[model samples]
Target: MLVNGFYSVVSWIFLALTVFAGVALVMAAIAREDAYRAASKNTKQFWLIILGVAFAIMLLVPMMFLQIIAVIAAIVFMVDVRPALRQVSGKGGGRRGSSSDGPYGPYNGGR
Candidate 1:
């Protein structure tokens, strides 16, 4: 009984994480154009895999593969992509704005 309850709780937690991750991935795809360009194929594939596995688990599998993939993507973002993006944007204590563009404001990268 106790073990079953624990498993139930764990499953729900994983489900929530999976949903949040899916939403974040979608939002990142929308907002971060540079990231979109940098990892266009990988980003699309990642979203498809994560969301497909999430729907499969929610509707069919009950195995939580989506959560696993999401966790892996989160780790990659934190360790690899974040640092690379910081360097690319010159935000690693280097500069507030780069020669290419700034924080997607009204400046328009014109002058």
Candidate 2:
């Protein structure tokens, strides 16, 4: 009984890791290519390939070693690359002219 319980917990953990990796992969795919270049990070295609491999490994191999590597790749992309891309792409809420700027207009305060 105890062994089976431990296996179940391990399975859940693996499943969660796989899902997280999948999310990271999708985010990498959706991000703009120019943003990656502006952020001075790896090209979007490079990251896409890395994340793609990580996701595939996570799905195909349930081994702890491989999962750890995949999780690390996902975490690196989420923590480092994603934030950089967001900053370069102006999607990080960096506060532009103002709400009245109309995305590319002159601001007039509250007028």
| Index of the highest-TM-score prediction | 2
**Candidate 2 regions with alpha-carbon error over 4 angstroms:** 93-111
Question: Which tens-of-lDDT digit does each residue in 3-108 have in candidate 2?
Answer: 9999999889988989999999999999998999999997999999999999999999867798799899999999999999998888895565755677567767
Clashing pairs in 2: none
Which RMSD values do the candidates have, in order? 9.3, 5.4
Worst 10 residues of 2 by lDDT: 93-102
TM-score for every candidate vs. truth? Answer: 0.44, 0.81
